[model samples]
Target: MGRIKPQTLLLQSKKKKGPTRISGTTILTCNLVVGLIVLSLVATYRQWSNRSRSQAEDGLQNLEDTDAVKDLKKFDLPSYAILNTSKGFVFVELHKEASPEIVDKFLDLCQKGYFKGMSFHRVIKNYVIQGGDDIQGLGAAEDWIMKGKPHSELAVSPKHEAFMLGTSKAKGGSKEFDLFITTAPILDLSDKLIVFGRVIKGQDVVQEIEEVDTDEHYRPKSTIGIINITLKQEI
Candidate 1:
């Protein structure tokens, strides 16, 4: 081949160098774009993680503020009332959490011997055994309403099961001192009665009281008096 010209060789060298410079510049630009994309994705993930963590913490705090949690904390200790009846003694578990005002009034009456010698005048077979009237009469009503302004709203709605103790409202809109223990489940009366306690022991005594002979007005033929009432607390 003929000897190449210096000018031609120089032109060819310049063409190769131009392409190399362009390739290097393109590679650097691509690397910068990829780096920026990776940085943006990492920042977005971190923000989402932080937000999720904050929401979870707020949800936990809200759960702690619920009424159920407060009730659980308040009723850590158990409270009860012991009814010494002429037939036998019956143990009652007070539902202070469900009806605080009613329970307090019942406990106060018990401490003051208000229930002593009060006979179980009304006895309905398979229904209820009611007492708490100072007089041995059946229809005579006593003031069961808390004396001053009520400490809380009237808990006329019951939330108790069988063998629960409750009071009735008199015709004059005031609660009566007459109290009753259910011999069976009574859901219909829940809206009208105020439940304060439930029988935890000596249910047989209640059964015996229920089996007593009754007169035309469902009054017990023989006296079944409340000898005394006492309170207890368990930690």
Candidate 2:
């Protein structure tokens, strides 16, 4: 065997180093591929999560739309009512400032005798008597009452759940527009019933109104008549 030259030995060493460099390059390329795949997976998961959340929110909004605040663009104001049953006449003045659009829509129903001969649907012995539900005889003549309007801002009582009476038109069904008077003082009703207008003179007349024998549902055992309605400006 012949002895190898120094240059030949050096050339062999260089060839060995080339293979190691290629191996390192291969490892780096594999790492880069893995990183890109991880990034894509994370992005896809985030997009899916966002879509799921959006769907949940849309479902909640649909439920709310069916109740109140459905068609805000169609809100009106200045609706009023006077219930004159055998018990007596109970005049109700509405608050139109907070929801002027909703108020006007209710007033139109009252002007049409839409609530005539309706029975006091619900009455709480020392608390309240709710009449405006056609199911009890005070509801809409031909149309059905849609869900009540959700209030944007409660000027009367934040905690008060009282609503007034109104009829449902073809465009929209009137849900709630009935008056709820407070037996307590002004401060007591501050956050309960939206006290837009009080009975300035006929309050005693309302106090003297008749109350029928009620069942658990507050339904009057007999019939109650709402004779006539008169409108006047608040002083």
lDDT of 2 by residue, 1-235 (tens): 9999999999898877443345888999999999999999999999999999999999888866773554443233333455566667666656556545545655665677655665556554434444554332333311111322223443454234332322222223445455444332223233223344444345565444324576655556776546556554432
Which residue pairs overlap in candidate 1's backbone?
Answer: none
RMSD each, Å: 12.7, 16.6
Instruction: Provide the lDDT at 8 for model 1.
Output: 100
lDDT of each: 0.73, 0.51
Give the per-residue lDDT of model 1 (tens digit) for 1-235: 9999999999898877443345888999999999999999999999999999999999988878999877775575348888899889999989887787777677777777788888898777656678865333223222221121232433433453558888764422334476789876655456556788889898999999989888866778888879988788851
Residue 104 of model 1 has an lDDT of 66
Where does candidate 1 stray beyond 4 Å?
A: 1-78, 134-160, 171-176
| Range of the 10 consecutive residues with the lowest summed lDDT in candidate 1 | 140-149
TM-scores for every predicted model: 0.55, 0.41
